[model samples]
Target chain A: MVFHYPNGRAYDYHKNENHPSLVNKVNHRSINHNRSKTIYGNRGMSLEEEINESNQYYLSQGIAVIHKKPIPIQIVSVDYPKRSAAVIKEAYFKQASTTDYNGVYKGKYLDFEAKETTNISSFPLRNFHAHQVEHMRACQKQGGICFTIVKFTKTDELFILPADLLFKYWDEQDKSRKSIPKAEIEQLGYKLNYSISPRIPFLKGVDLLIANS
Target chain B: MVFHYPNGRAYDYHKNENHPSLVNKVNHRSINHNRSKTIYGNRGMSLEEEINESNQYYLSQGIAVIHKKPIPIQIVSVDYPKRSAAVIKEAYFKQASTTDYNGVYKGKYLDFEAKETTNISSFPLRNFHAHQVEHMRACQKQGGICFTIVKFTKTDELFILPADLLFKYWDEQDKSRKSIPKAEIEQLGYKLNYSISPRIPFLKGVDLLIANS
Candidate 1:
């Protein structure tokens, strides 16, 4: 699959290109997405929506109790009719959120960010914020579980990358006009197998990673 | 010792007024002044800053970690220097955060909103959002501790109001022009006494409320 960017560069993910019908033959997983599409719908299915569904499934299965931190919106204009719901006429994006999702699982604090990249060659450093990095670093320092779920949108591949690895790549971006290469990610990152219910298969990788850590 | 508002209403928390002279005050009662200011800086602090400080304290103390969720800010303009941090040229207020603070506290999921009001007659219902109310309700239904800290700015009096009473007032606002009256807050709200550290003393109230519930 090839995606053309605004910069006019064509980036090929090369997913299922070698073997024809590979994508069609394999099933695409679906998350339990329960967020209000009417709210953030136009932005495609948001990360929060996917996580929320995943959390619900996890709760039902007695695995976890994670939830996406609500997006902070600075509502500028609102209209209140005589006797009905208040409508946000005009609102803008506020500051970047602290964590994408947080909860407890087996008496442990779970904090993480979910990001995606269409670019096949590398995951851009710009996809993350400085504060998010700082927050993750702080969490990791405090003996909490901190990681990121990186989705290769074109390949439909997800990886649970550690905060330390993220900081390393982020620091590398400072030295050059380079992103964290796919080769590097494939080496260090834990490849997440997908499924329909939770969709991300993050906890499976988490189990392996936490045990190793 | 009297602090007068624009409406000519005067309130003296009598913190200073109660101390007639240095010798008049009791030594045992005044000894608590040795506590650090940053420890309980929540008093008279903005909601955002207070949550940040509290999170820092939690992080330091190895308490239940809490943090203020960030806003998703979209910048319309920015100034890039030759070699310096980018300066925000133009940005607008984002949306209200999901909740003020959320974290693990004593093996329990804690979530709450912090608000301050200058109004003497009532705490404006406009200070909260429908989504926040709904979120709190959802958290409460799941057996989580959810509440709001309403600070009457002029009086420096803080009240920990549960979501249940808040929802009742919110529902009533549709039929009446009145907000949550101060009298009603006094009747139903738990007064969170100010302490040297974490000036809001919300946890003490949380302990009491959770025990009672």
Candidate 2:
């Protein structure tokens, strides 16, 4: 499927497969199954799909109230046909100004963005946007819990990195490397294991983050 | 403007003007100006527009990180031209499963739905969807701040009613009246005085709610 930015620039997912920053390509397939129960052992699912399933589990178990914000779209024109629903004739995807997943967790405001990389050694910093980093900074200042859920797709390994550490690397990117080495992530981040009920179960890491903070 | 629920039900705003439950009619006009500064003395603006302006003001001042979630739309088809951006050929609006506005404020998770009515006597409880109410209850149970922003359009009066009180009226609706009387809201809710920069300074009322809770 093809997507477009608000500026009318075409975003071809297939062409950007190797681009370091091309993560979370809008998965239209996952939209319809947002609240569906997790199909255990479905390793073929995208990080977004897993997160949505995990959020559904959290909601059902009364463990949290997180949700993935809908993709922002700019509709230019719509048609109202007789005896039928309105049809959006023209629309473009708008860049989101904030993180993707956020909600209340144990009375604390939780906000984070999810990213996946095929590279086994490091996670590219370019996968994150400047505006998203700025948004996380603002939320952190407000005392909200902020972090990034990084998945090494090659090994199916997941880690939750605190936003503070992300900010550290983000500010030093000009003077340092363009990515966070896997060794550094393993040293400072929390490693998550997949589960049958919630799939990713990253909130276990969030619990640790909350305890540390 | 016309919208459609996920079930293909056409929602015509002009035709539903008298529908008590039709509070927020999806103001497409406000989407583009989400981050724009408030145009002082613009009383002609809708409640949604004013709230967007207020959110912008709050964001700029580092007071809060509130935002309105994008309208959920299910895209059925898209056309990708040879060299141009993609155009949505067909799409339908999906019923939102949560409240409209949510964010972190002063280390607290804040959630709310905004509504307006021309009826001077009462604010109809039917204006809220069951899923939205259930979502709010879940958030409140998790200790997140939840409330409703009710506006009496005829008198230009606005009130911030806590979610607990809203649930009370909601539960009693089957046996009692279908609406919360204006007098009840005036007595139980916090009236918001409009401000120049934020347009609707509802956070001041939120501060009170936070303190009381």
Candidate 3:
């Protein structure tokens, strides 16, 4: 597929044109995709990149207004340029307290964080911070929709777990548990599948949660 | 007022001990505050600082969860110290497409931009950019509550103007009008009065807007 800019430049829509490693990963999945043409081939992309692309798709379709908050940077020094923009000479990345993505969908405030794990059996409890949990709890109390989108990279399965349910397992970690098993997540969360255009259709899982709630 | 940190250090809430010019500005307004005891003593603080302090008060009281989005920066180079955190060696400021503050309040998604102007009679249209207006419009279309908290620096008056009203004035700028007069704003917007603790009680204006809506 080809898209043309207003300036008449053509943009090729070929996959992994810029990243050879991503292309290699996609080629490896070609066998599985060839067997079942219905499933999406989300090969080498990180969960964050896939969600960001999904968000762009959502924005274009007027479905939602979600966005990843930019990483916060603590600026130390800036040099005033003689004939150009000011240059930040020194800075450092700052730790964030809340979740990654947030926005409004059909009058509901949506707040969520996305995480991925290689272990297919369970997701590590250490993936989330205490401050993030507190932030989600506060947002949930204010009637905002709060959840975590966890992806099992080994199995290529995604699930959206409610913040309250996540809190239940999180609070029990000190009692001897370390991770949330895949079976428990399957029982308590809504699973999502990728599609062609908007690769990660996580909002479908959100809809199910909303309907059940 | 003095705040004590967890480390047992006292933080003095005095104005501009570091910036002498800012202290002078505050001293210039001390005479006016003495005459009008009902007004807030926001003498030296920038509009951004006042809004941040107000947001902190709201957060502490669990009234709302509004937060200023950090300024985005484009990182160019980084230096990794062996035992310390990675330091950003070079970067540049990135333009933001959305407003500065947003949060969930009473099951409603609240989005707003805070702006201050020294102009006493009218708010200059140049204070706002085209992209920001588009962003506010998009949020409003999705049923998010959108507005602008404008501060008249000379008069020390604050008003919360609905985004729809702002759009009307903004669109007329192409027709030669460049500012929204104070009288017009007073007629269409909600004026907020400061209270003791939350120096800028702008949420009172939000309450009025909610009631009317």
Candidate 4:
């Protein structure tokens, strides 16, 4: 079938599909997701993989449409072989100004930064950059859903902290010279329950935030 | 002045303060940005340069908090020198499933795909991917503002066209036939006027669309 464009142009999705869409590669093997080694288990899912799976589940359920933004990389060189995939020879890590994931949920723009820390005491605000904090502030000012998904690696405890709180601490960080305590977090923040599918289950906190708002 | 993070780590952001954010050695000038090549004899700024300037404008005017998503890349190899910047030795292009730009605009969620085409006759749907169309559909369903900025390279004409029309043609494109024509686009698209800084003043069109909606 022919797919039409916004500019009124049409193209065949099946034509020259090899170079672009792997529409033909729809080989769905039994989705026993190959769990990575990051989870410190033989075959447990990583936090990112669980989120991706949760996103898929959410998409299927029509509850929300969200996806993690790819980590930005600055490429310096690429070698195009005659018959194989192009190999990048030289590149650099590009600093990201925004959070790791964002999307539309329940008609509201959702913007967030996800982070995991091995520390047990406090979720380090150091994981976030000044620009991301600024980005969240801008989003919050305009009534967007702004928050962060913080994971305490050792405890495996996750919390959805309001960006407002984050910024507040961010501003006073220089004067106070201390991290936001986990006990303080437990009082002010909403603790997220983990699940097998969407491991982080942070959206539940967003729902709670919206309802309260 | 030392800006301390929420985690008690401090950073100095005073112009040339030797802050890498990512690492100690990675310099500020490295991630600053690539100066885009000027296109026309009119000292024409590239679409990228214009977009960055527009983002800056958005920040200053308090109109929006939009940013271009970084190019997705897959890292294959890396080199860590003891005394120099870490150089990525190999990588490959990873497919992007969403639009290039997305963020908060006037308390509303905004999502869009921007492309510049040299062909004025008919903008090619090939420039956009099927997954992106699906992504836009997903975002639109959630009430996010999604659209495409089509730039005709010859005349430097930029058009802000909504994704609804894009979806219509994208669906029809699945048929076993032809692409959509250019004349239909001229009628449907909102031609964007160029300006000194942002060049393509798209938010104006977005405002008109928003007001009507």
Candidate 5:
């Protein structure tokens, strides 16, 4: 299918069989089929995919509205084909100035980043960037709920560590500290588990965090 | 200078003398030293540029954290150079799933689209898409503040029209109505004017609309 952008540019939609459209395509195993199933079903899917599915579920249930920011790209050159779609010939992915996922939940602003590691013991500090930490701090200062969703791939455990806690560990970097231990996260952060319906129900985790605070 | 993305990809920062950085380069007239004066000044710039400068102004004042969503692109292929930066070789711009701009303001979710029309009598309904109106409805359902910043280029008048009002006129399309008259907008919409420091402070208009509602 070919779709025209607001500016009248043509965009050719070619679906990859591996990743089908998530809109109303039901996979019997999973309740949600709005997005790629290849990114769901607990068969070692990426944390981002899990969260995206969770977001779809949240939207369907009127729980929350969150979306991953599209990767920023700097387009250097574009080729206007004769009687066809324009092709971007030269571009570079620009670094995002904000976190991965952001939206409004129950009238409160939400901003977060999702990361995963095979290290069962701890999440390395290197998973985060200094600018990201600063961005989160800025959001936090503005009263937005800021956090990081860390997944332990080996153990299949997920933790929503508050940005302030992550900042504490981040600032201690020069003192030779490397990672936040699982025990520390288990103690200070809210743990999120995988579910069948929503896949990764982080909003419930967020609710609990909000209630506790 | 080169800045590496959080994912370890390098982004080359090249300055175009035509448009200076909007962050902090003084223009002798605008108070903020950051960003482009061409995009900021009142000398016949696009409405999008005016809003962008206003956003930068709002950000500098700690008023809001709204940002324009980057145009989504479907990347077909990328080249990995051994010694230099990786380059996107083929890509196509994709239709956005939501509006142009969104963010958090005073803990309230803000989402909006800006449009300009040279027609002085009425703002044409063809300037909007069904999907954009649907997106606004969804955001409004979630209690997010949603509206359109319409600029009548001929008169240089700006108005913040609520999405519901837009939907009404949009639905009237089947009745053979092609546009919303200027008087209707003057009665129903909140008008905004250009200012010195912030340039296009539409948020003040938004505040009045909220207060009236």
Candidate 6:
């Protein structure tokens, strides 16, 4: 079935099935339909998917309001078809200037990025861009709660590292090792395990950060 | 000159000059370069452009970290050339599920949408969508600062209306007039005048909201 938006744009789930983002949304809906079984069984989900599910849970339960920012694309050309939606003919992906997920949590501004690495020893600093780090710093200076969620894929261990501690390693990149060691992250960061409803319960870590601050 | 992003995507300002958003950015840069004269002289600027300029000013001075979210698009297909950036062959614009702008300010979550109308007597209720209203309501419930920046293009007057007041009008749409009268806005909304540096100075209104709340 096709649904038309208020602006007259047609949205066909079947037509958009090939779109990765749309497919993810569809998969999420199916998973949500049988939460008890799929929530714990899905171990192959990406950190981003888990976070998106968690955000949905948070929103449903009135715990928080957060969303992943849409990917930025620079469109060069578009074609207005006679009887269908306008089609973008030429475009390129543009670099994002800020973190992926952000929102209001318990009246505090929350902002963070998520990353998954297969390396067992350390998470490479190259996973983050300079602009994202700078953006987080600016948000932190404005008293927002900023952090990074790093998932070690091999062990399926996830850690929430505060922006201030991330900044220390970011600043030391030029002078020292180009990565944050797993040992150090385990020592300083908050560890989170998978849960039933909100897959990645990172907000528990956020509550800790709020208490410490 | 062409600028290539770290991911090897080429960004040609000359080629993208026709794009409305990029054109706005270029005009904003020119306005920033000659803020003393152009900022006061450019009365033809759109409300979105003005808000973007204000955001840039805020970012430069470390006053806040706000941004206009990118328009979401649903990708259909792409083509990869031998030695160039991958081109999006087909895509469609997706309806946004949230407000246009959001960020952190003074440790609070700020979310808002900007609209301009030529009608001098009243601002039409149709300017906002149900999803956006619902999004704002959710954000407000989560303790975020949510509001609307409405500009009377005919009178060259602007006002920031709080989300709660907007919700009242939205809820009354079926029972009353489909628009909010100018007098009502003037009484309840915070008026804003164009100024130097941050052109729209809407944050002054935000300060009042924060204080009152």
- Candidate 1 regions off by >4 Å? A1-100, A103-110, A115-147, A150-156, A159-213, B1-51
- RMSD in Å for model 1: 13.8
Candidate 1 structure quality by residue, lDDT tens digits, B22-67? 1111111122233335344343344444445556766666655677
Across residues B1-213, which tens digit of lDDT does each residue of candidate 6 receive?
A: 123455664433333343333332222322233444533344645466778889999999999999988877777666655565556777776777888899999998999988767698998887788888999999999899999998776567889988888899899999898988889888888999889989989999999889877
Which residue runs of candidate 6 sit more than 4 Å off their true CA positions? A1-41, B1-41
Which lDDT value does model 5 have at B47? 66
What TM value does chain A in model 5 reach? 0.79
Off by over 4 Å in 3: A1-40, B1-40
Tell me candidate 1's fraction of native contacts, as a decimal between 0 and 1. Answer: 0.07
Give the candidate order by descending lDDT: 2, 6, 3, 5, 4, 1
Clashes of 3: 0
Comparing only chain B with the true structure, the TM-scores of all models are: 0.68, 0.84, 0.80, 0.74, 0.79, 0.81
For residues B1-213, what per-residue lDDT tens digits would candidate 5 score against the true structure? 122445654332222222212111111222222334435335644566678888888877888877887767777776656555567788876666778788777767788888767788998887787777877777777777889998776567889988878988998899868788888988988898888868888998778766665
Q: What lDDT score goes with residue B87 in model 6?
A: 62
Candidate 3 vs candidate 6, DockQ winner: 6
Model 2 agreement with the true structure over A38-117: per-residue lDDT tens digits: 44343546677788999999999999999988777767666766666666777866678888889999999999998877
Candidate lDDT values, in order: 0.60, 0.79, 0.71, 0.66, 0.71, 0.77
TM-score for all predictions?
0.53, 0.86, 0.81, 0.77, 0.79, 0.82
Any residue pairs clashing in model 6, and if so which? none
Q: Better model by TM-score, 3 or 5?
A: 3
| Alpha carbon deviation, residue A35, candidate 4 (Å) | 15
Over A17-116, each residue of candidate 3 has an lDDT whose tens digit, in order, gives: 3422112111122233344644445664556668888988988888888887776666666665565666677776666767778888887788898876
By the DockQ metric, which is better: model 2 or model 3?
A: 2
Candidate 6 local lDDT, residue A156: 70
What number of backbone clashes does candidate 5 have, counting pairs of residues 3 or more apart or in separate chains?
11
Off by over 4 Å in 5: A1-41, B1-41
